[model samples]
Target: MKNGEYFISKDKALLQTETIHQFLSRSYWANRRTLAQVQASIENSICYGVYHGTRQIGFARIITDWATMYYLCDVFIDEEYRGQGIGRRLVDLIVQSEELDGLTGVLGTKDAHGLYESFGFVRDPDRFMKRRPTNPWA
Candidate 1:
């Protein structure tokens, strides 16, 4: 695989597991995720990975009802691979995907707001709410 080339976006269960592991190892929000746990999560997600000759350099996942709302999550691009438009292309592919076509796409990011904004994602203060467990270990 080269830039702008991907093997396929479907049948991604196994590939998703690997992609998550690669990301969580580097991502602050998910650095504690174990391979077994990540594998289980991958089995239940609609995931996409961008590859460069068999190495996954970017990844994202969407959890959705497939009818109305889609939460895009875990987007990442390897540091060495940034500025190549891979992240933008990944978002484009997801937004344009027939599987997600008429649903609302949502995501939360501490950074990269500009990138998502370029794709028509806006901060809708009235539509967002969140809760975090007081004791996540429980």
Candidate 2:
């Protein structure tokens, strides 16, 4: 989906590990995340990469069963690319994607509440649930 000079695509091949690793490693939520871990995460999820010409500018991913629910995470835009609506566009595509349209979506963010809220995400803390497996690092 082309919006202005940036385009969003659910192409895992379009993702650059260095970019994802760099941002995630420093991100408040995923600090010190490794490149290999990021690669595996991308490989297993429905990923969208936002690009400018040949360079990637942002990314979002959905971990879903393609049925009743989805968890959105690792969403970010490059520092130089912030303040633009690119991040919103990425979220829009994810929330409105055909496969996820009828499913419940959940996400955790210390900030950026306003961004998600605009897309119909409500902060119902009682609904959040998580359980870490022994091999979660894998």
Candidate 3:
């Protein structure tokens, strides 16, 4: 729970939809991602929020079956909070969580390879492929 000046909580109430919408809409990997899509994702996934007391500073989600595999996604820290080790601490807590035990984990990041690598992630260039929705809004 407590990691230095930050802490991780699994409270969905801590999520600010407007703030998440604004950040993801501008992110290269998920540009223009609609609020409905974001809401749907949050509703379905296991969400973790990083907080400094009552302030939500970061978030991450895992889409998983809990018995086999999990895909970590939407991991982000507020731009103002990046320099601290909060991001790393957040990820470490997730990876070590009992809920995800014994599952193969995967994540996609255009960058941040170094950060993820520290947590036992590696390139699987030949093992992964993706297909985007033909009509994201549809």
Candidate 4:
């Protein structure tokens, strides 16, 4: 534990794919990520984990160029760990990091828009976009 109550750390190298897979499986939008995909994502992006006595209770990832743009993805908190400000702390650590300082952080959420809003995220009507991928296995 980092501060005697919450375990916070930014060590993707130590993340187990199985743990991440289980977390994403419970996520509302990302229940289909496979172990291989999760492993690749963890290896390629910056990831953070919140632990409760060695069990990962929350997770979040950011895909960024470290210069101009960032997309926050796959944020989830174990149902047992919700309502304790862990999610806020996770977001805070990411947004306040030097790696994301000058970039525009973006994320799409079906729920919890209010949480992101409290962290300065806003809906940009002009930034309309579309998804091009037709199949995940393609």
TM-score result, candidate 4: 0.91
Off by over 4 Å in 1: 1-8, 13-19
lDDT of 1 by residue, 21-126 (tens): 9678788777777788777766788888777767777778889998899999888888888997888888988888898989999999888899999988998879
Compute each candidate's TM-score over C-alphas: 0.85, 0.91, 0.93, 0.91
The list of candidate 2 runs beyond 4 A from truth reads 131-138
Two-way TM-score contest, 1 vs 3, winner:
3
Off by over 4 Å in 4: none
**Each model's C-alpha lDDT?**
0.78, 0.88, 0.88, 0.83
10 residues in a row with least lDDT, candidate 4: 1-10
lDDT of 2 at 45: 94
TM-score of 3: 0.93
Query: Candidate 1: which pairs clash?
Result: none
* lDDT tens digits, residue span 9-89, model 4: 888755666887987877777677778888888888888888887788778888988778999998887888799888888
Model 4 per-residue lDDT at 71: 94
20-125 in candidate 2: lDDT tens per residue?
Answer: 8898988997775678888989989989998999888898888998878999999999989999889988898888888898899999999899999999999988
- Tens digit of per-residue lDDT, candidate 3, span 1-138: 887778888889888877777778878877768899999999999999887777787889899987899999988898999989889988999999988989999999998999999999999999888998898767
Highest-scoring model, TM-score:
3
Worst 10-residue lDDT window for candidate 1 reads 1-10
